[model samples]
Target: MVTRDSAWPGGVPCWVDLGVDDLDRARAFYGELLGWEAPPGSPETGGYSICLKNGRAVAGIGPKQGPPDVPPAWTTYLSVADADETARKISAAGGKLLVEPGDVMDAGRLAIAADPGGAVFGIWQSRAHTGIGLANEPGALCWNENMSRDYEANLAFYRSVFGYDYDDMSANGFRYSVFKVDGNPAGGIGELGADFPADIPPHWMAYFAVADTDAAVAKVTELGGGVLRTPWDTPYGRMAILGDSQGAVFAVIAMPAGG
Candidate 1:
């Protein structure tokens, strides 16, 4: 399992959080569904509950800020050495800053941006909080992927901003590439196939690891969540796409034993 006590390398997907209308309900739902514990955070921390798995921080759940129109969804955050500098590079790379770089108390600085393909993601400059404490294991994040209609444009934007190297891994009929940071896989970029539904927007999707994808999906439905896609086997793992009761979609994968 991948565990860390220090800040992640810049350009790596370091964290993910869910912005929801009801924090209590979200905490309870995820706790039951994923075996997470999300006690109320201290007032000084803006009551941002850190989702814990076996007593280790895995993700976050917090109140949704901004206008009421802001949708409840899971946001993937990339690590950066300097949020302000990254913000400038993002705009220069043809991306728009949805939320300009700003300090999150003293924990870190962060900014949200949209790529040329219109997929929204965040950049985090860690200070007090170094993001996920455990990963690549059941009940924690394992992968993040950008599903885009314009893969080339999105890839170019990220490469320009994060200086990422990619390895083309397209096979069969799927077009996919693995984004690497210092020779280690950090994330993925996938082209939305023509068979993809028109209603689905381009976005960053977070995947959590599980021991049993089929069982996890069943528990999701049992807890009032919906199944976006049924369990299917991939070359990498058995996986399923699911949505919380609030309609925020995410994926869960049961990686082949050693993965």
Candidate 2:
């Protein structure tokens, strides 16, 4: 029953591309820390390098571009069935339309969008590219979270677009508003405060899995990524935030033993 209803091409995530301020520096830093092998790109692939873990595509690397408004950061692209229709629902749901749906030729449709709180993300309608090939793998994206001021709008927009459901239920003193994709447990959506710790913006924060939180936090400093959070516990696992060598912000979660 391979129906088009549940169809998400390339994969659900295909991969995440980091708009790095310095590709050479990021290559060196992440290379040492994550043990990724990034080979040179060709004309067909543009300048983006495909990062491999144990010789498989884990993520991608590309130089940052755009106006002064562009910050060096990682943007998450979620797989959807129809990107144009999803973009329409974004505006109708009170979210901002950042980029209109455009064709990646035969690759599929894509559009950039922001939630009610102005956190930017991309919607990928995969014709050829599905999503990320590897998730929950070391150095790859483990999870993505939307920290927002308006949880209702955030939940509504995503629910309309990807047909996701929110738990909105708390457990063990930690609020776990889990995001589900087509009824499967996905990641999360958390509340954002104005005076939040460490100057975090209302944005989608990606989590990369690491073997050790303490060691990874230490190596973040050694590799030139700045730490925002020390190791902390949750129902999921231990996690921390750090800026990559190129100054793009992201986080890493160290899974607990026997979980």
Q: Local distance difference test, per candidate?
A: 0.92, 0.73
lDDT of 1 by residue, 101-122 (tens): 9999888999999999989999
Q: Any runs in candidate 1 off by more than 4 Å, and if so which?
A: 44-46
Angstrom error of the Cα, residue 184, model 2: value is: 1.5
Q: Give the TM-score of candidate 2.
A: 0.87
Q: What would the TM-score be for candidate 1 when compared with the true structure?
A: 0.97
Stretches of candidate 2 above 4 Å error?
Answer: 1-14, 43-46, 171-176, 257-259
Which candidate leads in TM-score?
Answer: 1
Each prediction's Cα RMSD?
Answer: 1.1, 3.8
Error of 1 at 247 (Å): 0.9
Query: For candidate 2, lDDT tens digit of each residue in 1-259?
Result: 0112233442144447788766767777788878888876665656677787765566678877567668888888877777888888888877787778999657668888888767888888866655565667666777778787776777777776566767776555444488766566667877764456646678888888888888888998987678877789877798888887767888888876643
